[model samples]
Target: MDYYAPESLSEALDILGRGGVTPLSGGTDFYPALTPGGPRQSLLDITRIAALHGISRQAGGWRIGAATTWSEIARAELPPAFDGLRAAAREVGARQIQNVGTVGGNICNASPAADGVPPLLTLDAEVEIAAAGGTRRMALSGFVTGVRQVALKPGEMVVALHLPDPPETAVGAFRKLGSRAYLVISIAMVAMVLRRDGAGRVDHARIAVGACSPVAQRLGALETALIGARPEEVRVTMANLGALQPIDDVRGSAAYRLDAVREVIARMLREAGDG
Candidate 1:
């Protein structure tokens, strides 16, 4: 196998445009996917590219580089509204994986159980992609097409993720129901952001469920139901998550995942209310 570590974003895109080059960020997902006879030939390492290596505040919100690791996100002192992301970051894997698994890699991998997607979707995040000619930004929800599938073009590479400013009254939480406590793929996961009025009624709510669908989806119906609802009322709204399409997989059955969604949503709402 051959390796090329680009020092700039343009160089990386140029390599991608040539085709047959696997773009590597942190290599957490790529290395594992490659076995004795796997389809990996050449690696285009982008971690050395300075333009794709940090988090910064941008025009509309924040821009997180593709190479930023989960460990970096977990350690950052973000606003309370980003608590859900921090929590998900901490649960991505053991300490070692967190230190090496980049947020871009997680999104690019496009797994149904990806821990980062739920929180990013709840934040209304956008993904920035660059190819040989230009760049484009697409909503995270639209960027992911299905399980292990994304809308990125053949020559395009995810450069950064943009997140809008969070509401001041916002409080967020995340919950994952897996078979084991640590280092396990989630059977179901929930990421929620709630903004309450001064009178304690929910002014705005964003809820997303993962590992239960083709792609992690925001519970728009549930979010709408929670509007103007009190904390106790929020729990009641969570009981109706059966509308989501969950599949029976090796990790869990469809019925169990549906039930787990409800339970995780309730737990997230309860935690958000406590803070």
Candidate 2:
């Protein structure tokens, strides 16, 4: 196998623009998909590229580099609104996977079950994509088109993810239902962010559900319904969550996943409100 480890993001993007190269971050997903005679001709190791690592606070929000691993996110001291992401980080896999599996890799891979997407979606995060020429920011919701498909062009690489500063009263929660507690793919997962006014009434809310369709989806209808309603009204709004599409797979049936979505969202909203 041909291997090229670029020292900088520009070099890496140039190589990717040349075509026939697969950009690898942590390789947790790439390595497993490799077969004896796979389509990948060359391995572009972006991990050595210093520009694609680390996390920092930006002017309007926070930026997490594409190479930032789940382990790093799990250990970072971030705001309370990021608690859902931190919780999802711990559930990405076992310790071994967490050490090498990156937030960017997970987002790029675009799996419906990707543990990072729901939380990132709830945060209304934007993905920064870089190419040989320049960089562009795209909303996280628009970046993933379908299962295992992203909006990235062949030459573009995800540089970092930017999360806007959450509201002061915002609190969030994440929950996943799987066959077992650890090392199991999620059947259904929910990430919720809720902001309460000084009067303890819900002021704003965002909820995203994952592992139930080709892409994780934000519950916009439910979010809209939560407005002007107290936390006690959340259960009624969540009942309409059956509108989401889920499918039967080896892990679970569509019917079960749909049911779990409503239950999980309700629970997460209640918890976020209570905090």
Candidate 3:
């Protein structure tokens, strides 16, 4: 297999523009997907590119470099609003996988059970795409078109994730239901960001659910309904969670996932209110 690790973004883009090469970083997903003795493809390793390295604050919010690993995110000194994301980072895989699995790779892999998606959705994350032509940004929600699919066109690659500043008082939580405590794919997962008013009523709420839909989805209707409710008064019904379309699988049944989400959402709201 041909391997090229470019040290600069321009060089990386140039190679990608030529086509017939796969962009690789960390290779946590790539290596696992390879079939032994299969037709070998050339690899364009972008990890050495300086531009895609760390997490930093920009004018609007924060920028997480595409090559930043899950371990970095889990240990970063971020705010309370990032708690859910950090939690997801810690749960991405075992310590070994977390050390090398890039958040960018997680998003680009576009798995329905991806631990990062629900938290990122709640953060309103944006995907920054780079190419030989230039760069562009898109909402995370629209970037992952379906299971194992992304919106990148030819010669395009994700460079970083951009998040807008959220309410200073916002707090986030994440919950996952899996067969085991560690190293298991989620049966269902929920992430939420909550901000309260002076009267202790919810002012801002963003809720997302994963492994229960084609793509993780924000509970827009539920978020709207919780606007004026107190933490203790929060209620989640199957009707409010209409955004998710769960399917029966070996891990869980669609009905069970829906039930689990309601409970998780309720608990997260209560904890957010109490804290």
Best by TM-score: 3
Better of 1 and 2 by TM-score: 2
Which digits, one per residue and each the tens of the lDDT, describe model 3 over residues 1-275? 78899999999999999999999998887888889888799999988988998999999899999999999999999889999999999998899999989999999999999999999999999999999999999999999999999999999999999999989989988898999988999999999999998999988899999999989999999999999989768678888999899999999899999998999888887787777
* Segments of candidate 1 deviating more than 4 angstroms: 235-239
The collision pairs in model 3 are none
The residue-by-residue lDDT of candidate 1 on 1-275, one tens digit each, is: 78999898988999899998888888877777777976658889998988887889877688889999999999987878899999999999899999989999999999999999999988999999999999999999999998889998899999999999988878878888888878999999998888999888888888888998889989887888889987555654434574478889889999888877887677666665665
- In candidate 1, how many Å is residue 198 off? 0.5
Candidate 1 CA-lDDT value: 0.87
Task: Please give the range of 10 consecutive residues that has the lowest summed lDDT in model 1.
Answer: 234-243
Write the residue-wise lDDT of candidate 2 on 60-158 in tens digits.
Answer: 899999999999999999998999999999999899999999999999999989999999999999999998889999999999999899999878889
Ranking by TM-score: 3, 2, 1
* Regions more than 4 Å wrong, model 2: 236-239
lDDT of each: 0.87, 0.87, 0.93
Model 2 residue 253 CA deviation in Å: 1.4
Q: What lDDT does model 3 reach?
A: 0.93
| Candidate 3 Cα outliers beyond 4 Å, as residue runs | none
- In terms of lDDT, the best-performing candidate is 3
> Residue 176 in candidate 2 has what lDDT?
90
